[model samples]
Target: MTATESARPGKRGGTGRGTGTGAEAPRLAGVPLLGSLLDLTSDSLGTYLRARGEHGDVVRITAGPPGLRTELHCVFSAEGVQQVLASQAANFRKDNAVYQEVRDSFGNGLLTSQDEDYLRQRRLVQPLFTKRRVDGYAGAVAAETASTLAGWDRAPDGVVDVSDAMMELALRAVARILFGTDVDTTVDVVDRCFPVITRYVLRRGYSPANFPRSWPTPGNRRAAAALDELYGVCDEIIARRRRDLAATGATGATGSGTDTDTGATTAAAAGTAPGAVTAPGAAPGEDLLSLLAAATSADDAEFDDTELREQVLIFLLAGHETTATSLSFSLHLLARHPELQDRARAEIAAVLGGRTPGAADLDRLPYLTQVLKEAMRLYPAAPVMGRRSVDAAEIDGHAVPAGADVILAPWVTHRHPRYWPDPERFDPDRFTPEAEAARPRYAWFPFGGGPRACIGQHFSMLESVIALAMILREYTFEAVDTEIAVSAGITLTTTGPARCRIRRVDA
Candidate 1:
């Protein structure tokens, strides 16, 4: 929830458990020893969809051998998801193995930190993502997107792998925002190093036997090398930022990577500013990195050097990858559906013809917003969210054991027949304000809910809306390589190219 929303749980049911009398979740059949390992490792989306189709809302999936199996209690019902994420959130913890891998690689920052650590980090970092501050970064997003469109215009035959393009676009945009004046130092995260580290985390996190990361195995060694390079780069940038602030005798850890502090500071790449980057809608501040460096908790506590590095790492990792997935898939969906594309573009033209989009225009382009929401519902970035049950609980009348690894999958829940009619159809109207209001809160949660929801919610929406508006206005897209495969990584990533042919409206 945003800082503006009330923390009160809306209305409560008698038991809040669904229409059953509390029995163990039905299991999907699997091989004797291996269980569902092959199915999951090969096609996680298909497996989850099939399980939800065969078994009802909650299904227990056991994978691996007898001695070391991984059991996942999948909750695909919107009500059950609400119970896990919002109502009984305290009963579900982020103590899963994959999260541990995140802590090891990125340090115990907000993404991997639990309970009090998470609360403290949230207290210190929440202000940076306030609506006003993030809206201010729309200029930076526009600037970066302009460069991307230029590249697309210059591409041979006007053909491009939009998946790859968006990955580059999102990485550069987020990097520039994260380390404003020193953005060039963040190049390592964009191209070479970060992928290796994430791949290693995915592999080791899912392996039945997670050998110690310190082992001399080839994967571990390679991962270690990548981690060192990433940590060193972040540390260098943070240290330099602190030094610059100290040298200049400035207060609040070098005001947001650029000029004055009152507005969202013309914060872009190290040198994208040519004017006062005024964010006309909300309150304003500097770039997130500087704000993070300068922030103090309620008790006057501040993040230490290492702590600062951890927060920056989490920001970069989470912010960049997830937003890219949303943009890439949105473009893909719009490309394939020309009727929907025109409808959205018509709304965009009506609202923001010549002027660039700002946070204020968000409410004006309702169709475009629905299109984006529909894309997110189809392919949520974090498809399967893992949480361990803190105590034995009854969900949808299913008895969940304590310490069980539970999953809340937006990929499945967004498509639940109960909540979503014509589940496979890509209908933007499903997200119309009225329709959304009629559904359960968790029915279409692209960004997970409750207090632990993504703190970067406003920032993500700001960046995505600005980029999508500009791109849709500038060019028309045709799906070139129409079909693609997807898999679950740190986020949902395309395993193959999603190529699109561009027809620039101006050219």
Candidate 2:
């Protein structure tokens, strides 16, 4: 049973403000030497929830041993979440080990850059994500989803892996939008290589010490090979974009994978950039890659060829993976609940009525949007996000040391009994405007919070809403895999196929 709504872990303040005075955060001790390492990595969702339930909103988890131990300050309260991510965002920077590894692999794009560098990058790229701008990409989402539904039509016994389907749909849609028609070579390279690279990052990120990349160990050699391929393809693509920009002189930004090992720099025979993109695509120089390559700062600064590659990689990773996670989980959740599925499908059919969804359709289909939001609340794309405390800070009166690692677990926060009744239950009604207005802002921050929030949020919403609305409307899906077991890496990857059985609504 949940505690009363007013029964907070401790004294609480308004949004982003924690009420207690200076004190030590409750320490969570675990297995000898490894501390909480085994419990956390094995099942972080359960671990974080148990920690909050036993200790309070603010718990300290120390992992590793002696001089090599890492102290993690876990903040679970909505108020503390706001404090760490919004009001006191300046006190927390993206200097965590996992993030550094990300920057090393994906480059210092908006997701990792901080301070002045972040501000300049934000300024240059923010305009491209505004609602008006993102709305223009709906065609890409619809086209890709239409293709996904068609592929599902060929599935044997009406069974399809929605997880793989959503992942492919999101990657292809974002990639097409980003690179336009000339990106046939990127999709496959990214799809194959991202997993190899991220797995290495997750392993190295949590270790107390690591062998240098220059070492020719098995892991190092494999990662280096993946990096070489990934970097070479993206570098070629960047070079190609620069060449194109110099010729036609237009500007902006672009994701997804391809099927061939052909490099992205060179177009296929007939000078056509070949791959799988077959939709109403963007005009010349209007694709996201072109825009980012052409973007100039207020001070007239622009991303160098290297910086452009970095930002491009980040866009592809952050844009498609998170959106795909949300979409997959959303469909899986609805499949498990027939009533909710019917309600959402009815909403889609009433609004979309077999016509392709448009950017304007986002508003006209509010109930379906709520369904997506509900799914996200249960399984956030970024289940666990990390930050580093830059200075001593007070949260609910507990003092955090400078340079300590801080964790803002949205997966746990979204389940706070104070805000969510029957926290584990799937209920889209919890997201109605009236219900949303009643809660604190940070109570459900899946896209993160504060100024450093994911810049592609609008793009994500557009893609998810359009895709889900379309998928649900066209097909009647029943859950084949009722339980979704997930393990977190860079994003929440389902442990299995996350399968569902789909039949045409007309049948």
Candidate 3:
């Protein structure tokens, strides 16, 4: 069966025209040629908010130039979001141009891959993020959080850029969790290169001009240099791990068709011989790289160096960047509301007494989790999730033609008054067990849903919880700026550095 036929199995509805029957989705009229492009470019969040407020759940927005006009249908209701992300998800795929642009930099990693390749890659990496595996990394996360905060202890003015600091902390933590030994070097490389590459990618994705990366423009050159440095570091790490494994005779540790911690069968694992050289602080089975290195497919085929590098890079980038952004926004929110900050701090003190938090402590700190959830709802790390319809589908009785770009915006839906009353207010109680049970599932999907949802969500939540607990234990944060300027890119960020004043508390 064809994609469109499969998408709409039951009955043919709607007038075959662009607009459907029952309450046609209002289209935002724009300029003669530029259309809604200018409005979208200026302030996407504002534009989405206005469109949803004025036009209801489904709002049709037109952009691009005259002949090549691009139309996007923004779905901003729980029911509609469910249709796009869950019910009829198979009818939609990550064929968006923006996603394709991202693939150029990230390769065919999980975030960018689609169809059979995506499913295969997802299965390969799924084992690494199981709850058990994620819990195992909590100690590393807490340690990194404490170590990063130690530097803040000696700040002369008690002022630091929360965004940059969180990014640095998250980068170090992810490097250790993913690489294990000599992580400082890896973290340094990623920290230096990630910003340049991400900024370039976002710029290229957002700009209307089709500037190829090979153009050798100044921005492209810098991005290329950064990527080369990043890849070089990854190559070095992979080679070093393989050498270590070989020396220890741990190569092929999980032979063909054997179930390992990652729950996948490997053909020729990177084994290490006895008396292998081990780094001073390295612990067995702690790093993801070690696990991946010692793994092969069920068919007895070892992963190539390129494949290894891609997996490592994807984990390093996605593992840290989104968590850092979420933490930054969470901290900003708490700083703005002193009552919530005090409550969180009190909860931390009551829970830990005097010691640092561990994975076990995460469950006990419910308030901290609530705060994080609310913050994510208000300013999701990924403000929008874009998908292109592979077949003609009906969302809330509206016809979505094949190949149309369908946008499911958490930023808008999370704040939609229909689902969340007083949505703009920062109320952690909204996530309480009873309160959450009262709302729809797709109403607040910060990490997304369905089979394609983020696999590392458990890891992200654990890391955020531990980091927030550690910070709240020792320092009281206050916002420096009256208002934060939210900027939307690959991830949500601030226009300027999110600066906050920190006051050290008695231990």
Candidate 4:
């Protein structure tokens, strides 16, 4: 994967731009225009490595006909990401080609919105993710994990796809905390609906045209039905909560159960609590939804139900899939390298001495955390982040014009030899506090950076730490697959089943 081997011999020449020293940037001149374009859609990382090896960190690609204008592709250093994500950040906008499709399904959520809308939505949702609120939900997160794990077949002969299992686990856990404690009961419904929508998004970037109602495309029909069912479910829950508020003037919703109501009814039920909390039948604790429903900007503006639903759905995907992918991959890595897993377990034992991890325990479980960090560094779930240039600007001194897409990939960045020492190796100690402090800010961005960084990052980390610790404490995992192969879709995932054998830990 080194630059010299990847760069084509004759296609090497210096592009007089950026800070690159006289090294020639990789170019594929004789290849048909279609071939280059196909390479972009088909093998982005391969294209990036060639460019990086030839041109240094930042390299540009021309993917189409000369008359049509070439697409701009830049794979710069961590410092470049910092520059783009910071000081000159306003020049970069999130309206990318792939994300346009995501926005159609997710609506104007924080992840999709730009400018004023982005600022407003971020403000409302930020408070709910405060350290205190996140910590408060830890017990509930653990309880849900335990509940899910309780159902697993722990016998030696039983093999499970830990990736899929963790995806289901994460989806249910986040849904319960955000929507209601009983949301896990609907994981099957989510599984049924989400795949259809995600597949549609993957296929059809971001088009608004509705499919023919008569069209029997199973995916399309399923997506439409799932959307309707999800809305119906949310409305019904909201309505029930409203009814409960009318019957009994209550404010506190204990973590024991769920309240089904339309959001309006939930608000009505909450009434005039000092902090503007949700009704008794609302979610168990103050979740992201409740916070949005309760928030008002300095100007006293609030997000409507549509806005709330969009944001909630965005979190539904973000809060679950990406982290779950990382978790599943980490487990895959642990299975492949049992000695590494053993080292992590020994560290966990020395730190906690046979007890479930608390908030404080996260700091003590440094190696386990490092392992997770290394796993993500290599196999980032959300591999590619794209931003379209709204204003013509310079990215690492290359003239990037308006309307062109700019992509920064963690998949490439994490593997870049300049930043990552022995990039391909699965070494967790590299993420030690001292090691991290020595690296540039953007060198390790598993959850991304800037104002747009994933808000549920803390939530994801807490979930991962707890889940990994619990699994390590109870069982030992070994890989059954010959070699792990990754596929890129909505997130980076195993090409096939991530099968693993589990053996119970004996006292």
lDDT for each candidate structure: 0.75, 0.76, 0.74, 0.64
Error of 3 at 141 (Å): 0.7
lDDT of 2 by residue, 198-310 (tens): 88888777666789888999999999999999889888877887898788755443211112111121111111121232344456676778777877744747889888888
Task: Judge candidate 2 at residue 70 and give its lDDT.
Answer: 69
Runs of candidate 4 with Cα error greater than 4 angstroms are 1-30, 64-70, 154-156, 206-222, 239-288
Best by lDDT: 2
Clashes of 3: 16
Give a tens-digit lDDT track for model 4, residues 338-426. Answer: 99999998987787565556555567788999999998988888776666555656666555555655667778888888778788888
lDDT: worst 10-residue window of model 3: 1-10
Between the candidate structures 3 and 4, which one is better when assessed by lDDT?
3
- Candidate 1: segments with Cα more than 4 A from true spot: 1-21, 253-262, 265-285, 298-300
Q: Write the per-residue lDDT of candidate 3 for residues 201-237, one digit (tens) a residue.
A: 6666655566777898899899899999999988988
Error of 1 at 220 (Å): 1.6
lDDT of 2 at 148: 79
C-alpha TM-scores of all predictions: 0.90, 0.90, 0.88, 0.82
Q: List the residue pairs that clash in candidate 4.
A: 101-205, 101-206, 237-260, 237-261, 238-261, 238-262, 239-261, 239-262
Question: How many residue pairs clash in each candidate at the backbone level?
Answer: 0, 17, 16, 8
